[model samples]
Target: MNFDTNLILSIMPELARAFGVTMLTWVAGVIGAALLGFLVAVARRYGSRWLGYPLRLCVEVIRGTPFLIQLFLLYYGGPFIGLSLEPIPAGLLGLTVYGAAYFSEIFRAGFEAVPPGHVEAAECVGLNRRQIIQRILIPEMTMLVLPASVNMAIILLKETAVLSIITVPELTLVISAIGSQQYAFVESLFLLALFYWGLVELAGRLGRYMEARFSKYRFVTA
Candidate 1:
């Protein structure tokens, strides 16, 4: 069978709209997850056992469960308890919550990687708790975590496809719809892969740029 380049071009507009939705959700979800995960990591690191244990347990539970099930539970289960969420919001919330669990572990490890000597040195130099965390700990941890965080971003980007299961009309939903309607399953799937490939490539480049930017100071001082 011959591939129809024209058909692929013809669906670009629809796919573009769908891709926009996918990107928007990704941005919102990742931001929320990063913030929530950072908070959770900090709590686990600094809080007492009473607080830390529950946070750790929560992260473990979220990480252990399938993301699709979590999405379904949030969207479908919410209504039974009188919490009604619209499609996009529910999908974003699900992605954020799912991503947060993983990101928290990444952040926790990053925090742990900062040597106690560093914090002690900062304290010896009269840096307050906030000063030590802000000027010393966070910067070092960010550099260490950059690679893992980028990989997680790509994973989350692909996970956006699952949002289509609930009719969120993201890239995968649009591609599948066109494929089913036009009987061009192979072409549609190929385009889907292409889009994700482009996104992953772009994310990797951005991550590398950030890593370099963060490393510049260390290189200069050394």
Candidate 2:
């Protein structure tokens, strides 16, 4: 098989353009995950068993099912429910829901890992539940949450591949379309592999830096 150098060069420009879209998906996915997961965790904590059970069930159901199915549900399944989501919206929604489930667990553990003394001290200082949660709990929980959040961000980055199925035009879809259109099969996929690897490497280094930074502010490294 003759490797077409010209084809690779042509595809590189398109891949580079699509790389921005890929990063957008990652950023949106993480934002969605963080907010959704935080809400779920809060609901579990404050909403008590009534609201908590359903949230837990939601997390379990999402985690149990494959993301491909969820993407289909958002992209293909929503129309039946009178929700017309575009491809990117569908993909974003699906990844958000999926990432939320994992992130909820991360958050729950993080909140739990908050030292009891912190909570008690906040109470003694006349902090109400809301105030204590906002100030004491969140700050204390960060020490625990930072590492897991770092992991979740990396996981979400990898999971962006699933968005391709919904035709979100993310990195995977971009490469797949290019490969099929141009038949620069090996080069296109190889470039994608390289792109994803580079992202993973960068994320690992950033995570280490974050760990060091956050660890400094952690209270007794509990």
Candidate 3:
């Protein structure tokens, strides 16, 4: 069978629109996950046993289960518990929660990688906890975490494709629908793969650039 270049061209506009949704979802998810993950890491590291244990359990639970199941529970099962949400919001929440679990581990590892003497030295210099975290710990952790965080971001980006299962109108859903209606699965799937490949490639390049820019700080000690 002839490859349908025309069919691919015809769906470019729809693909572009869906691509925007995917990007928006991914960007928001990454930001939310990073911030929440940092907080979780900090709380688990410094909070009392009561708080740390629960947070640890939650993190383990989230990491152990599949994201698809978690998303289903949030979107489909939530209505039973009076937590109904639209598809997009549900997708965003699921993405954030799922990504946060992994990000927290990455952040925790980064924290551990920082020398304890650095924190002690900062404290000895009369820096309070917050100031120490902001000025010293964060800068040091950023260097350690950048590569792992970037890898997690890419994983979260790919996970957005699963959002279509909940009818989130992301790239996968739109392309699959087009393929079904037009009987052009080959063309549709090819375009979908191309878009994702391009996105992942761009993300990889950006990550490498950021890593190079930050390499000088990686070896800097307190």
Candidate 4:
């Protein structure tokens, strides 16, 4: 089939809509995963055996399994247990849960990297556990963990393409649909790659900007 530039232009609007859906899915999943991961990390570090052990097991299981399988289980297997969710929600839920396992590890490492002396100093200064964590530990961990967190965000962004499998009308799904309808498979795929490359590049630039700014802020404060 010939590569048709006009055909590509014709489908741009549809692709844009699908891209919006992809971004929405990524943003929701990443935000939810980050929060959940941080909590799990904290629990693993500080909670009791009853809470920590189960959280550890959960993180392990999620990290061990394939994301596609997890997405399928959530989208397809949920109804058997009386939990009904739409395609978008199911996709977001799977992404959040799966990404959390990996994010938890990154966060756990960040938490551990906090100097023990700092905690000791805070204690001697009459700071309570909450104050120590809030003021000293969290800020240090943010500086330590921001780069890894940005990498995880990119990973989650790529994973959003897999949601097409469950018919969530994301970019991949839109591309496939246009290809089938227009019989311009090559053109469709070319555009798909271009779009993803642009998005990945944008994410990388944004990550670098954030890291630089945060690093400068840390330096100034120091």
TM-score of every prediction relative to native = 0.95, 0.94, 0.97, 0.96
Quote the positional error of residue 19 for candidate 3 in Å: 0.5
Q: Between candidates 2 and 3, which one is better according to TM-score? A: 3
lDDT of 2 by residue, 1-222 (tens): 556778877667777777888888888989999899988998998887888898889999999998888888778888899999988777777778899999899989988888788888888989999998898788778778887898889988998988888777778998888888877788777878989999988988998898897787788744
The residue-by-residue lDDT of candidate 3 on 1-222, one tens digit each, is 557998888877888899999999999999999999999999998889999999999999999999999999999999999999999999999999999888999999998999988989899999998898899889999999999999999999999999999999999999999999998888888888988999999999999999999898775554
Best by TM-score: 3
What C-alpha lDDT values do all the predictions have? Answer: 0.91, 0.85, 0.93, 0.90
Better of 3 and 4 by TM-score: 3
Off by over 4 Å in 4: 217-222
TM-score (C-alpha) between model 1 and the true structure: 0.95
> How well does candidate 3 match the true structure in TM-score terms?
0.97
Model 1 stretches with alpha carbons more than 4 Å out: 218-222
Give the best candidate by lDDT. 3
Segments of candidate 3 deviating more than 4 angstroms? none
lDDT of 4 by residue, 1-222 (tens): 688999988887898899999999999999999999999998889889999999999999999989999988888999999988999999989999999999899999998888888889899999997898799888888988999999999999999989999999999999988899878999989988988889889998999998988886452222
Clash pairs (backbone) in predicted model 3: none
- Report, for all candidates in order, the number of backbone clashes: 0, 0, 0, 0
Show where candidate 2 strays beyond 4 Å: none
Could you tell me the TM-score of candidate 4?
0.96
